[model samples]
Target: MQQHINEKIEQFFRDYEKRFRDGLAGNVDTASITSAFADCFIEASPLGVHCGKNDAAFREAIPKGYDFYKGIGTTKMTIGHVTITALDDLHYMALVHWQSYYTKKDQTEVTIEFDVTYFLQHRNEELKIFAYITGDEQKVLQERGLVS
Candidate 1:
């Protein structure tokens, strides 16, 4: 039972990773990424906490996120370590480490590593992210001089 659960979670994240990668590259529609989240979700970061809804405004903002990264010369975003903890039969928490690669104007490559803790809910045998917490990525980028 545990193995089966693990397999399912792994598969889910694998699919999510692809969607995220494609979304960032503007190769897939925003729905491809938004579909992975619950209709309503919570996002907490060093900036603050906010409730997000998968609505028209949210969809419109998706491309802007990608644009920001692209403007900063982000080449790719990669998944690193993933740790999953089952809170119960219907809830789970996952700590996903990510690495984003960028090329600066000086033609130098930089990799920024970060981790996000996601709360997921399983309904109808599918997992969707309900909330997530992250660190201060903006500060990191500024300190690194990737962005002003």
Candidate 2:
């Protein structure tokens, strides 16, 4: 049963990623993305410090210079893997790694690979991200001299 729930949660994240990418590309309605995340609180690290208090707080805590409603313009999000550890019936933690390509309005493309940790909770049978941290892979690679 726990495994089933974990799979469902993983699927939810995958679907959410697809919707988010579509929204960023301006190929899908923004509301669809927002609606998909409505029931869950999202507390993004390095910003959105207090956003998990409630939905309204989350909306107001949008990172400076970022418009959640406007959505990011990402061309692709290729998730390499997602590993979920169930804390209990309603709580879980997951580690995800992915490569993202972002397209600017002028058509310039930037690629980034990141590893993220997600703390999730189930509310009303829907999975929501309660906390998350995104790590910069390029910085790590540079520090290790893997990239110049």
Candidate 3:
């Protein structure tokens, strides 16, 4: 049987989704999203590249990605298939599917979809993400012609 979605986790994603939509609309800042993650948060992209507290590669990559999207006339993004698993009393793991629609630098409108799992910790009554393992950054890049 399929487990029901958790309340807190659902609310968390709802908030995140709203913020992400705002970001795509250029109504909110990207730092707001980045701030939600831990300083040492680690991320393993779908391509298997790792970055986070132990690595800073994702920092540069993320911002560049934002710029790329904006340059490509990205106006909206949708996030779906969110599921949160309670890892313990104070920790949770979330799996989310995200799709971004944008015009490529060449003015081609395309959408890219990917899945990511995030490890979140509750601290001071807030959820902070410490890790994210993505499912297909390479495929996303290839689809967008960002990679050959």
Candidate 4:
């Protein structure tokens, strides 16, 4: 039963990622992008020292910082792996491995890889992300070099 629920959550995240990428590419509507981000939170730094505890905080902070993708340029995100751990019948945690290429307003492109963990809870039968921790893989690579 837990496995089945986890699979469903994984599917939801897959669809969410696709919608986010399409929106960033201008192939999908902004509403979809925002909706996908609903109930989600992200840590402010790679160390996990600071974090966004809820959706409202994420929404407020994103517009001021990372929301640059909305107007500044395009971004393509590809998720490689996702691991889900069940906390209970109504809660779960997921670790996602992903890479993204961002095209800045000046048309300059940069690619980076990162890992993020999301905490999700079932609300009204809907899986809603409640918290997230983001890490910077490039910085880690620079400090420790590549590792297989």
Candidate 5:
């Protein structure tokens, strides 16, 4: 039972990372996001708050996020670490740390580290992300001087 659960965690990360990389590279159009996130899901990100089971919201969230990076020019993201902890037989929580670097419109380069936690569950024989909450959004706003 433990091994099976572990396998699920490993596989989830593997599949997610592939889709994430493809999305960032602009090789795909939200395939992973829409599939990984179930309908009626909630997503809270540094960029904005998108709630409920709307596939269109999930589909558009990534692109909207990337637009910031793209506007800054030459954006790159690095996944620092990911830790998964099983909350129960059917649920798990994944903590992910990542960083993004980009050149600002003023031609200055900056990097920001972000942390996001995702809640995953096994339902109908598949693992799906039902909730995603972001951290340090205020700091990001301050970085861009969008907020005081």
Candidate 6:
């Protein structure tokens, strides 16, 4: 049972990573990424916490995030590490380390690593993220002068 659960969680994350990478590359629509989250989800970041619903406005707002990354010359995003903790039969926690590659205007390549902890719940026979806490990614980008 343990091994089976591990395999399921690993596969889930792999799919999640693929969606994120494709979304950043503009290969897929926002729905491809928002599909990973529940109808209502909480996002906690350096800016603040926001409880959002999966509405048309939310979908429209999703692309702006990708645009910001692209504006900063972010070329790729990859999963570096993932730690999955089974909270219960219906809940799971994932601590994910992500590496984002960027190119400065001067042609300098940069890789920024950050961690995000996500709380997922099994709903309707599938896992969906309900809440997530992110590290100070914007600060890191600003410190590196990737954004002002």
Which residue pairs clash in candidate 5? 40-53
* Model 1: per-residue Cα lDDT over 59-142, one tens digit each: 999888888888898888878877889999899898988888999989889999999899989889878999999999889999
Candidate 2 clashes between residue pairs 3 or more apart in a chain or in different chains: none
- Please say which candidate is ahead in lDDT: 2 or 5: 5
Q: Report the number of the highest-lDDT candidate.
A: 1
* Model 5: how far residue 63 lies from native, Å: 3.2
User: Which of candidates 5 and 6 reaches a greater TM-score?
Assistant: 6
lDDT of 5 at 146: 36
lDDT minimum window of 10 residues, candidate 3: 1-10
The residue ranges of model 3 lying beyond 4 angstroms of the native Cα positions read 1-5, 46-49, 53-64, 105-108, 146-148
Q: In model 1, where do residues sit more than 4 Å from their true spots?
A: none
- Cα displacement (angstroms), candidate 6, residue 113, comes to 0.8
Candidate 3 clashes: the total is: 1
Alpha-carbon error at 118 in model 5, in Å?
0.7
Predictions ranked by lDDT, top down? 1, 6, 5, 3, 4, 2
TM-score of candidate 1 on Cα atoms, chains taken together: 0.94
Which prediction has the highest TM-score against the true structure? 1
Question: What is candidate 2's lDDT per residue for 54-87, written digit by digit as tens?
Answer: 4555444433213332344445677878899988
Tens-digit lDDT string for candidate 6 (1-148): 7566667777888888787677777866676677888999998997899898988988888888778888899988888878989898888898988888999999899998889899988767677889999978878999998998
Report lDDT (Cα) of residue 85, candidate 5: 84
What TM-score would candidate 5 get against the native?
0.74
Candidate 4 local lDDT, 45-66, one digit each (tens): 5555553443455445444433
Winner on lDDT between 2 and 3 is 3
In angstroms, the error of model 1 at 119 is 0.5
- Candidate 5 weakest ten by summed lDDT: 66-75
